[model samples]
Target: MQHFAQYDGEWQNRAELSCLLDILAISSRMDLRNEITKEIERLTKTLVVFLQNPNVDRNKLEQTIEQLNQLNLTLMSSSGRVDQVLGQVDLLKCLAQRNSIPGGSCDFDLPAYHFWLNKPLAERLQYTQSWTADLTPIKQSISLLLQFIRSSASPNTVIAKSGFYQQSLDSSQPAQLLRVSLERNAAYFAEISGGKHRFSIRFMLPADTERPSQTEQNVHFSLHICQL
Candidate 1:
């Protein structure tokens, strides 16, 4: 949705429709609302424990807890799955069915969709907003959860000798996410692979027509092992 908002071109309209269909398909297969509600409840309980610590920021902690509470309530109060409501829209239902076929959404295949895409920007946005309204709670909850998880760990400077690095993970306290940050203009990029017990990173140079090769020189980068 954020990406779809960057332009008002015809291609952007196609992308917006694609995004909506993708979200509906994925959300329909899982009990996303229930899962998010449970996660929020768990996070709120975890945050409440920090309130007793003198070193913690009480104001910020309380605010986050309140936000989680509101999100949880909103999820609980929402009547049905977001996909179920969206599936009722005739255009979207047709789009969903035809989306599996190659070139199935072309102008001749879906004239109504083509016509809708050519609608005025304001009218298109109005319909898009209405279609996405049910998704706001899920989006907000996911964004907040990601914010908390990403900030859970501090970044540490690490060097990959000969463009390779490996580390064993503690099974008792496994990491939820691993983040590697490098300079924007750096010549090489980090390729990371991991499992329950260990992880590895290799810096590789990009190639145009062939497979990328690992850089022989040591690479310095910041790594974050987010456990929360």
Candidate 2:
């Protein structure tokens, strides 16, 4: 294909290679395989917090342990190291989104905007201060998250899923996010499939769904790899 023809022969371009590795990183997300693969990262972080505090809030701490128990189910399919890195990235996104629920119709609320407009300047300033205190770190995390988003970014799913990287995909449509690059690092793409003719990536779907039939190959994705 014309797209892959660009890097068909040269594999030593470090910049190109780095980009490739980063591409592979997000490729895991596009196909939806890595969403659950991020358990190791999540558990390790939670474990640290538990140890540090010695008395983690029981309800919240219990949640981490439960998730850790599911880690094996999520990680069984991929190589340990490769999967771990993806999981760490997902963990970062998870940390960013822990309490916030995902939704749309944002920025400003019509009724609320009118109400705020009627408020005095002193109240507006106080509201701004409160909003900034609560939202600034989450905003910063989102900025960092953008650097890790490789294939494509969808406004719908700001959080990554469960794989080594987090992800959120359309439940009825096989949405794709692909990133192509000439440069990559060998560390990320280890073994190179024992020198295979070509390498591609794919992922598993979440086990439970609202409409099981919807995901029985009805809404899934594939990441095709091309060498140029």
Model 2 worst lDDT run, 10 consecutive residues: 186-195
Q: What's model 1's overall lDDT?
A: 0.90
> Which runs in model 1 stand beyond 4 Å of their true positions?
none
* TM-score list, all predictions: 0.93, 0.20
Root-mean-square deviation (CA) per prediction: 1.6, 22.3
Tens-place lDDT per residue, model 2, 50-146, is 6557566867656645545454344454343332333544422332233144431122423343344345545544543442332233233333333
Per-residue alpha-carbon lDDT of candidate 1 for residues 1-228, written as tens digits (9 for 90 to 100): 768755788889888888888998899899999989988888888789989999999998998899999999999999887898565788988988889999999999999999998888888888888888889999999999989989999999999999999999999987878999999999999999989999999999999999999999999999999976
lDDT of each: 0.90, 0.35
Off-target runs (Cα >4 Å) in candidate 2 are: 1-115, 120-125, 151-228
What lDDT, from 0 to 1, does candidate 2 have? 0.35
